[model samples]
Target: MALAPRHLISLSDLDDGVLDEVLELSARLKRRTGRGELAGKTIGMLFFRGSLRTRASLETAVLQLGGSVVNLTAMSDFWELEEREGSVMDGRAPEHIKDAAAVLSRYVHALAIRPAPLGNSWDVDRRDERIRAWAKYATVPVMNMESSLWHPLQALADVLTLKERLGDPRGKELAITWVHSPTPASPSAVHSLLHAALRFGMRVRLAHPAGFELDGGVLSEAEDLARASGGTLRRELSLEEAVRGARVVYARSWQSLETYGNPTLTASQRSRHIGWRIDEKLLASGQDAYLMHAMPVRRNVEVTDEVLDGPRSLLYEQAANRLPTQMALLVNLLR
Candidate 1:
């Protein structure tokens, strides 16, 4: 048997071989969810942020494993702790992250946390960094629900959906569209999804409006990975042009990095680019294009109801895979 990952933070943290193992294990566990393979285990969930998929997925995965989950939400009292200065004991909140980590470790077999980034733009990458830093002191293995920088678990489920429909993604045209949003949330899903696809040699197109472009160095990094893996990367301003005949279209709203942590500017800046919204017209360009999103999609904004509920939408699968992928991650780390 292969070794398991003690904690999952970012896809970039795992090599291709390890990632493949996770995908395979997740598929198996998904098929045998009620088999009691991991009975009597417990998972502790701490969210300094809000989540729908992450929370539900982890809860379900642990239960399927015959384990239990404990959930913690960021509270006003916790925010007060952030204000305290000096010694760990002096924080405004009653508990420090280090203390919280150790305490949670005592009762749970593994730890899962979702910390929202500080800036107005949701920097999923940065969230990964913060959570990992806390994990350094945690005795138990850590699982990332969604960090500012990457959503590895989410990506795992996403690719699983792709593999189900289109076998291997290498050389397949996939579009990661930057849909219009009222705010910029760092676009972690876009960054990580593309990062994963590129690593496996898939041709990827990133479509977004001007000034709404992704991090400058990200493409170059993905390009380097693609050059070695037989995939291609393209960036465009036209949604229809990018989606034309594409095999998969992953849509999500993200805050502009240019706007960074400024919420005031995010809305105004993104509105000018509202033309990027995904609708039936965009899908017309690619009749066979498969539609995807990480969920919590804003209706009439990032996607239309027709398209979201359409024949091509693989969103439920994307959402459902969260449990098995996370279980694979948890099992790898804790087992």
Candidate 2:
């Protein structure tokens, strides 16, 4: 494999060998957190929107590796600097992203950013295109915190979790099913999980309502990957049918790509919005299977409090692995 230097902007960016290396290295580094592996190194983190796990986990992970962090609420200072009436972005704004990226590159080992795409709108290609545009001129490698289309870091952590739980995933049945949510900005967890599960050679099933299919290209890519890995990708509208004989049933919500761009009236149609809920019936189908979900989940919507807190739930383990998985990513990209 042609390994390059820096950045983990997408899951597709890393192949199997590179991905495994990062996972192994992360385990080793986490065991030696105080040894100062990156004592003098610093990383810059910027967020254009809100965050919980993505923010806290990366900060903790980098610190454990003996690295320091510089965090910026980008949309705040960056926005003020850009929209100031007469200040001239040339002035106190001090620098544009181009300049900031270049200067920061000289100080920090890498930069991670989260630019949340508009809610209920799933235009990943557009979002990623813009990110790539900025990255083209960046001085250092850029790790995408979460982009319009993909959340590679989350995917990495998830893959590691699967590996730790079920050993090799080569023939394991893994279902990436869409659960219920009030809005479309439910997080790109399922998209990333589908891609990761397929790429890691797991037999994958995608269950979602009729009009709420995943991105066309992402689905196609996953299909190709699944075929190549000796796994299969099957889509089903019935959650029970999808979860049958699965080792893991992962649930998440995403905007219906078919309804993208019409934010005003999409939710007005109540029937469309409720097509993705995870009630008891869905869980009962996979009674013996492990339940997985990326956190910040809605209380009564996507999953009931009972299921989320139940013994079958592995949500906590999934969240905990974010630290080590990220440490692995940082080690490979920076160290």
Candidate 3:
């Protein structure tokens, strides 16, 4: 990218000013919609993993902005693009990310990429080698739909949900609590949640088991943002304590970093956390907190039907905001 083209690689990629501007733009576009300024623009949508909302929201967002999408999904048209440095081309993968990235940059006005199939290697997974390679080589602006490290699009919707519900996010009591799940999950949503909250100076309480702490680097960033915003960030062991008197309770599940990228160990660790499910009883422990989650949730696993289907649940609104939030972002990049 020349002198830094805009890329939503992570929440940090966009400063608070720009991010909040995007949110405002999203709200405006949602109310009125595009003027078709980007009618002939095309965005390359490459999904190395399966997606429901991200794929649909992005394509729809582009279309709404009068831009089209060239979609690519893994296994169907997606193939392995080697990302390693100076690797021999004798492996099963025939193409390199550099060449593929160059082509993608040339064809589309901008590009959005999802995570590729991750192997058993925890080290490789955390590195996000594939997306990094794409960003390094692609001249066009890159968008991160979701990656092993973060899910910024979901996080943007989350902040939009919070803003829509709470008015101003500044100084609000927000709690991010870990809940039960069928499998170990990525920390993407949680990461973005903290970044968004702290960016706006919201008091953020993070509750999780001993093994389920977030990445240290990401935690440090949240701490810095909180400090800068005059917001407080507390890591609490008690779920009830974390949500106490909070306005919003973000219930989500993430793989334990202690056993991160290790399925067997992650399962073993969460086995002790079966009681961590979020429900009415838990939400009531707080001050009539609004419940939020980036779904499709394992209803009974992460939360009971009552809480998920209840009035406090903001899941659908959050899902709905994904469309406009992405539409604003697409226009920003394409224009």
lDDT of each: 0.77, 0.75, 0.85
Residue pairs with colliding backbones in model 2 are: 179-276, 180-276, 180-277
Which residue segments of model 3 deviate by more than 4 Å? 1-4, 117-123
Give the alpha carbon lDDT tens digit for every residue of 1-335 in model 1: 63433677778777888889888898887777556656888888877777887888778888877788777787832442232224556535666566666777788888887776766443444444568766776787787777776677788888888887889878898988888777445566777788899888898888888777776666778888888898989886478878988989988888777777766776778778777778888887874888999888888888899999899999998898888887786666665
TM-score of each: 0.90, 0.88, 0.96
Task: Report residue 135 deviation for candidate 2 (angstroms).
Answer: 2.2
Better of 1 and 3 by lDDT: 3
lDDT of 2: 0.75
How badly does each model clash, as a count of residue pairs?
A: 14, 3, 0
Instruction: Give the Cα-based TM-score of candidate 1 against the true structure.
Output: 0.90
Q: Candidates ranked by lDDT, best first? A: 3, 1, 2
Superposed Cα deviation of residue 257, candidate 1 (Å): 0.9
Instruction: Tell me model 3's lDDT, rounded to 2 decimals.
Output: 0.85
